[model samples]
Target: MFTRIGRFVVRRPWLVVVAWLIAAVALTALSPKLESTTDQTEFLPSHYESVQVSDLEKRAFPGQEDQPAAIAVFQRADGGAFTDADKADIQKVATGLQAKHYAHLTKIQADPAAVSPDGKIGLAQIYADNKDLSDTTVTENVKQLRVDVKELLSGTSLKIGTTGPAASALDAQESGDNTDAMIMMATLLLIVVLLGIIFRSPLIALMPVVLITLVYLTANGLIATAAKVFGLDADPSSSTMLIVVLFGVGTDYLLFLLFRYREFLRAGMEPRPAMAEAVARVGETIASAAGAVVVAFLALTLSTMGMLRSMGPSLAISVAVSAIAGVTLVPAVFALLGRGAFWPSKAWKREPKNALAQRIGAMTARRPGLVAIVSGGLLVALALGALGFKADFDMGGSQPKNLESVQAMDDLQKGFSAGKAQPTQVFLENTGGGKLAQDQLAAFRDKIAGVAGVAQVSPAQPSADGTVAQYSVSLAYNPMEDKALDLVDGALRDQAHAAAPDGTRALVGGTTAVLADIRTAVERDYSVVFPVAGLAIMIILGLLLRSVVAPWFLMISVGLGFAGTLGATVWLFQGVKGANGVLFSLPVLVYLFVVAIGTDYNILMVARLREEIRDGNDPREAIKHAVARSAPTMGAAAVILAGTFGVLMLADNSMLQQMGFAVAFGILLTAFVMALFLVPATTTLLGRRAWWPGLKEQAPNPAGEEPVLVGSGRTSG
Candidate 1:
């Protein structure tokens, strides 16, 4: 099937190229603008407690202001306590900000009591017009608010800084935009330089950059169109992920084909026929590898979190698009370039000795049992570190500490309770639609204040119709801390539910509560998505290899690589670096990249092993030759892919750093240990049984000539 495709593409390279161009243009012109949100609450299902609280708030507190409010903190520039004059100047700035009628500004609130006990700081609240904390309008308002605050504070001793959800969103977006540029620039440079070195041809180095760019535009357009048509809430980070996956995996598939083409050329085949043959040989492996990634990504749809559900399909689409381009567009472009694809270099005409690969291969063939034991032991040792893994739900904690919002948060903690800046709220709705007495509200508030973690509770504020009452509860600890999440998720929630009046329903809502529910959802996803993805990948492997037993062991090896990668990350971030924990999403992110992308190396190695065996080489000789041949391609591809992810370590975000290290390290392990040493050695040990239920005898040679096995010029079978 792939042979036919290669033939057709090579015959009409211009036509294939033109078709891709037209499709790219049309898709870009027609697709809707891709949109993303930073609102975590939107990602949760309506059935979750956090979402339920949100719904109740809207219905019962219809007139209540839902917009996120920023706090403007003022302090004397000389580090002394604010005097009466400084305090008066701070109030003047707050009044001036309110009068400016900024685009999203709703109101401003200031009070003398808001000053700290040390008299070093004063606070003013700037409310936004929108409910979305990360909305562009709110972000814009924050930008203008900062500028206006600075202008108003001119010539005064008091200086102002803002913090809160709106300010944080603005700062985060700016930081992310800069980070995205860096990531892209680094990825492209790595691909170009690495490819140039590998092929010794500038043209070949730039080919993937040019072609994958087109694929990225097309994939993004298609994703946007799908999101629009299906009303999916695609995460903002999906675009960044798409860029890496397309370039990394797309380049990988191209390398697989190109290496095979070069091999055939060295065997004295013509360029066109060699290209066709290369496709025919490597197409199934590429398809199977992509199938594993697509299935793994699609499995995210089963996730209870809307972000994962949407991201799964979006990433699946990207991998599918990249796979298609790898088989079609890439081959067509190279067909036109022909021998010139490696112009200015004659390396493609000769095969290098690759001494390291040769040595590893020879060792594996000679001492399969020892090689297997060593490789397996290393993975087992690394896997032990995963037992200490911890999850951090504080998204802001991953942001750079130097960010204005982070600085503001620190400042706020000094003047108030750690949780006072973003207090948790408990909502009580009268089930019977009756107004509650003040005495009943007081009793409920007393019950909540009595909870061990509760620092203070504000008097109940009733809705206009008196059907619901809300109380702001501040915790003794920082709201994003594990202690706070535990308190809200466990005792506080339970106590609130139990202490509600006879006809009232109690629901807790806030940042901490939302994170607590998200933790639950993520835990649920681990159970469901992992098994489904594992089963799906195994099916692809089984079908590709035409053997059930091979897929089982292959999956086990990949699984070990995944656990080792995660364990290594845990050791580095939590155990060694003394981080509170890695990002809550680390496990899922690691699974997606390591398990799915790592399988590509396994498929390439195993496929070559089968081919070597079919050529009449004995099990041990086949292991040596297959490893010698496939190792260079796998190693080069792994390095490039791993390096691209490693660029994330340059990011200020700790989450990105963790992800970068984990995925990159996993790729190296998969290529070096599992795919290279362990898999081939185990296959040699298993012998013909590894290909059970499939042909064990040597395949017939089309030339009707005896097979000349590598390393030994002996004819076999």
Candidate 2:
């Protein structure tokens, strides 16, 4: 099948090249203008308590504006109350915001309670004009409001500072931008230096940078299209990840193809034929490796977190696009470049001693069972960590501490209840035509306070029309903690609703409620996303390998890799690190990166195995031959890829560390164990029957083509 494909591509190389160029141009042009949301509330279903509460607020207070996403907090240097002149200046700033018609900003309140304690600080509650505060227009309004506030406060005794959702978001954006720039520059330098060292050719080193840029543009366009067609949500973090995956993983794929291409060229094949045969021989492996990664990313759909679920499709789409580019775009471009692709370096025409890979390969070939047992046993032991896995959904905690929002949260936690930063609100609304008495509301608050897990209940704040009253309920644990989420969504909410007056309705909202909703969204995503991704991967595998049997077990092996990675993470973070729990989204991320990228090695190994078998070698010979030839490429690629992810451990955040460990470790395990030991051993045991439906045939070698096995063995491929 691959031989036929090679012939077809070689015969009409121009056609393949043109098709990719045209597709790249068209897709790049038609790519949608995508926007990502970091708004935690947006991911929740409207039926969830937080969403319902939000909806009820809008309905009950039809003309009321939501709170401004940001606020300019003004304070006197002397810690004194604002003078009438200071008040007037603030009012002028507020009046300008009103003139601008900021979405969700109805009016600004210069009320005294809006001020902080010690009479030094004061706040203007900038009520917005619309419900959706994340709109671009709203962002612009906030920007203008800042300008106006600065102008109004000019030369005044008060010092103004903005600190709220918008301000914090802007700060985060700046930090992320800085991080992105630094990471990109660092990654670029790393890849160039590493590749340059490896190939000893500037042209060869620069190829990945150029190729991956096109891959990035193409993948992004396709991902945007997929998101538009399927209604997938992307987060702010997606761009950083996309860049890394495209360059990092794309480089790995390119290395895989190049290594094989170089080997073929050294064997005396001319440039064009060597390139063609290279793609033909390694194409299935590249496709399969990509398929495994795609499947693993798609498995993120099975995550019970909206962030993970949404991230699943976004990343899967990127991988799929990269995979397509790997086979079609990469091969076509290389085909056009021919031997000159290695300009100034005739190293491709020579062979390396490669004593290390050869020795390891010889050992594995000699003692396949022992190799398999030791490697497989190590993964099994690490898998035990998964039993202690716990989930933490603390979004606020993930935010950097330098931000005012985070600092304010800490201050609020210290001064008041920890829940003051984000309290759980229980709302009781009038269900009957008649309004309930104040006593009924008080009684409901009492009942809610007495419920299990409640720390305290603040005095009820009545709605403008008095049809609804909101009571803030504090909990003993972080709102994102499983126990707190369970408390809010389980007994507390249920009990509050049950005990509500017949004429009144009840709903829970705020941080805990939002968390509960997020959990539900994640659960729904897990059910929908994982299956689609897996099916897509299987289809790609089946197409590449032309065998139904091969794709299934490959996926199963990758799945085990995922489990082992997660379990290892649990042990490291939960047991060793002494943390509350691993991030709720960690498992999904590990599954996506590890399973997907890990599969690349498997695909490379398996495809080589098949190629060996197709050349009329028995399964045992194929396994030995495949491992000997492919192990070096796989090891090199895995080291580079794993090293990239390993840098995430340098991050200050625990979440990034967990991700770094899981993905890096998983890649090593996948390459060393699953791909090298398990796959080869299983195939060796299966022998000729493994390639069922495509029986082994001792066909004559093509004219002028000498059979080349990895170390002079009668291996497959």
Candidate 3:
């Protein structure tokens, strides 16, 4: 199948190249912009308490629902306590801003009663005309409100800055946009520099950059089109992640073909046939590696979390597109470039000495059991840190501390209750669908207020129908902290549910409740999604290797790498750095990338090992040569891919920094430890049994794939 594809592409390279160009351009022009939401409730299932509260509020209250779109925090110019006159200035500013009746500005609430105890901070809550923060009108209103507030405060003794849902959303979106640009530029530079260092040819370095850029455009357009057609909403971080996946994975596939293509060239074959033959030989390997990634990602569709469910299919689409291009478009481009792909460097004509790889090969060959034990043991020791891993669900903490919202919120906390910014709300719906008296509302509020973590509970405001009541319950701690998680998920929920009046059932819903639910959902995903992904990946490895035992051990190695990576991160963040916790989703991301995407390195290495064994070398000899040959490819690819993600560490956001470190460190472990050391050593120890039922070690070598000489650049043939 691959041979036919190679020949066809080689015969009409121009046709292949032009088709890809058209696809990228046409899709880019026609597709609507891909959009995402940051609203936590939007991602929850209807059954979750938070989602239910939202639904009930929207349905029962209709036009009455109004939350702050932005909070205008006012203070004296020198940061002194606000005098009575200054409070009047704050009220005047709010009243004047309200009179302008800006678009999407619902109402500006400012009160002397809302002043902080320290008297240094004053607050004004700006309601929006819309609900969804994704709506640009909300963001625009935030911008306009800031301008209006500035104008209203002109020449006054006080200064005001806006912070809240709309303003924070605007700032976060801008940060993401800038970070995405930085990630792209950094990834491109990283790939080019690494590829140049590895191949010693500027063309080889620049070729994958240009080719993958085109493929990225095509895939991105397809993802947007598919998402729009299907009505799917993806996670906000999907675009930045897709950038790394396409370039890192795409370049790895290209390198696989380039290495083999150059081998055939050194063996004295014509450039076109050599390119075709190279495609024929390694195409299955590339397909299987990509297939593993695609399946693991697709497994995310099983996730109950909407973020994972939507993100899964989008990433899978990207991987599928990259794999297709790897087999077709990449070969065609090289077919045109031919021997000149490595121009200005005659290294392609002879074997280059890779001393480090050779030494690793010799060490594994001399002591397979030792290498396997030591490498496996190191990973296991590192994996112990997983026991201390803590999950943080705070969106505010993940932002740069310097962000206006974060800074303003911190200032507010100094003079008010930490959780005052967004308090937990509990709703009581009359199950009998009857009116609720003031007594029942008071009794329910008292019950919630009795909870240990409950600092304050506002009076219950009954709906017009009188069948529901809303109470704002502020906690003694920050809404995003672990104390908040336990309090909301445990004590508050328990109290509310247990103490409801006979005709009323209570539902706890707020930022903290939503956070606790997200934690529960992710925990459930661990049991469901992780197992499903593992099983799916094992099936792919089993089918690709035609070996039952190999898949099990290979998966074991990858799993260890996942744990090791997490443990290392936990040690760094939680232990040494004294962080409250790593980002909540770090484990999920690590498992998906390290256990799934990292499998690519293992697949490449093991396939090479199997090839050496099929070429009639002893298992130990095969392990030696395979490590020597595959190490350079996997190492180069790993460094480049890891660097691409590591670029995220440069981001100001802690979420991006944690994600970047996890993936980058995991990739290094996957390549250097599992693929380079453990897998080959263990395979040598297992010998022919690794192939088991297929047991093709002594089988005849296929005609097109002659046993290439391992020691030298040229083939034995």
Candidate 4:
């Protein structure tokens, strides 16, 4: 089947190229504007008490003032107090910024106490009317406001900087943008250098770049169309993530095929036939791997958070596209490049000794049990990190201390109750027919204020309709703290609701409430999304491998990988690092990337195993041959991917660093242990049974060519 595809593509290279071109051009043109949300609240469902209260607040108090989007904090350069003239200048600065009419900022406030304790720093509250912080326009506006504010602060004695929810969000966005650029550039350069080194051909090095570019454009276009048709809400992080997956995973898949093609050619086959045979042999693995990744990402649909929900579809779309490109565009390009793809280095004509890979394969073949036990133990040790996982919902703490937003938050936390800086609002709604009296409201406030975690309760005010009363409750801790969430949902909210007068009900809304809702949303999503993604991935695996048994274990291996990765991240960030909490969004992010991409390696190795099995080798011999042949490519690909993600750890944000480590570590484990060691070893132990209902039952190579299988000795069984 792969041979037929190879022949068709080679025979009609121009047709193949043109087809891909048409798809790429059309998709790129039709692609919708990708969007993302930095506002953690926006990711939560509207049904949570927090979301409900927020809605009530908006409806009750139209254009209600809350936290400022960006607080332009100003201070004297030499650490001096603000003069009356300095205050006047600060006012002028605020006025000047407002006059600019930056779309992101609806209002700006310059107050004296907006200053720091040393009398050095002052602040301007830049307000946006947005209830949803994750909106693309809002974040972009915040970024633009930062720039505008910077210009306004020039020439003033005050060394002014901005910090607030909006500013922190903007910083994260910019950091991700910068990080993506560096990672992509680094990955591309590495690929170019590595491919050039391996194949000794610049043309070969450029092949993936050229091919993946087309695949990405086309895939993005298709995703836009799918999103438009299905009404999928695209997240901002999707675009950057898609870029990495396509280039990173796409390059790996291409390399897998090319290496095999080169091998066949060295055995004296013509370029067209060799390419076709190579694709035939390896296509199943690429497709299966892609399927697994797609499934894992799709599992995110089961996530409760809108961010993860949105991210699942976005990443799934990307991996699916890469898979198609791996099978189609890569082979077509190789067909066109022919022997010239490996030009400048006649190395393609002769096989290297490959002493290192051969030695590893020989060892595994000699002692599959020792290999399995040792590799599994390493993953297990790392898996211990899972025990210490903590979830941090604090946006301010996520960034570096040097960031103006982080410093400002720190300052705010010192002066006021961390809760006062961001308070939880509880709305007592008249769910019944009539309004309640002031006494009832006062009684409710007293009860809420008395709750265990409550630090202070502001006086309650009646809603515009006079049917609802809003009370602001400050906590002793930051709003994102677990204790805060517990206060709102457990003791505080329960007491508030319990104390509500007849004909009235209570709803809690704030950052903590939002996070609680997001957590619920994620749980619901897990049940729905994980199974669907798993089933879809299995179907893909089934079709590619023509075996039911393989996909089941593949899912299990990938599933274990997810758990181990999460466990490790928790240990590192929360246990050892003593972080207040891991990023609340880490689990979802890990599920989407680690599981999906991990499946990519699984498919690669498994497909190669199947190929060897069909080539007249025993199960043990087939496992050894498959590992020997596929490990180098799979390992190379994993290293590149891990290295690219590892760059994310350099980010000043704890969230990004955790995400980087988890993903990089997961990829390494998948490639080295699961794909190279466990998968092959397990399949070998399963023997002909592994491919039951498939063709492995047929005699190994009916033609009886005495193939030189790589291993024959050790089996766990």
Residue-level lDDT for 367 in candidate 2: 74
Q: How close is candidate 4 to the true structure, as a TM-score?
A: 0.88
- TM-score per prediction, in order, is 0.96, 0.83, 0.96, 0.88
Candidate 4 residues 503-614, lDDT tens each? 7888888777887777666667656766776687778777877898988877777777777888888877777888887877776667667766777788777776776777
RMSD of each: 3.0, 4.9, 2.4, 4.7
- What do the candidate models score in CA lDDT, each in turn? 0.87, 0.71, 0.86, 0.74
Q: Write candidate 1's Cα lDDT for 540-592 as tens digits.
A: 98888889899999989889999999999999999999999988888888898
Q: Write the per-residue lDDT of candidate 3 for residues 1-717, one digit (tens) a residue.
A: 787888888899999999999999998899889988877788878889988998988876778647657778888999898887898898899899889887777889897788887889899988876878557878877777777777788878998777777888888888889999999999999999989988889998899999998988999899999889999887888989999899988988988888888777787777888878778778988999999899889988887788888899889998889899998999999889877878788877877787899999999988989999999999999999999999988877888888877888887787778888788989999989899888888888888899997888999878889899889988989998999989998989999999997877899988898988988988888898888889989998999888999999999999999999999999998898788999887888899999888999999998888778777888888877888888878888889889989999988888899999999999999999999999988888888889887757445435776432233453521
Sort the candidates on lDDT, descending order.
Answer: 1, 3, 4, 2
**Deviating ranges (above 4 Å) for candidate 2:** 1-26, 68-127, 133-164, 295-305, 430-437, 452-477, 520-560, 574-578, 618-620, 647-654, 685-695, 698-717
Which candidate leads in lDDT?
A: 1
Over the stretch 1-717, how does candidate 2's per-residue lDDT look in tens digits? 455555556567789767866777788899887777875666665566788888787766676656546555665656477687776666666665567665545676665454444444555655556555555566556666667766666677776655555555655666567666665776677788888878888877787788777767777788888888888777877776776777779888888878877877677666556666676667677666776676767676565555665776777677777766666667667777777778778776666766765666566666777876776677777788888887778755666677654654453343334554356878889976466688898899889989877878988877777888878787866676788899988998898889899878899987688888787676566566656666777777677666777777777777778778888888887888787888776765676677667778877887777777777666666666777788878887887788767766655456766777788899998998888787777666566655665554556657876433324233123
Model 1 — TM-score against the truth?
0.96
State the lDDT at 167 in candidate 2: 58
In lDDT terms, how accurate is model 3? 0.86
- Backbone clashes in model 1, listed as residue pairs: none
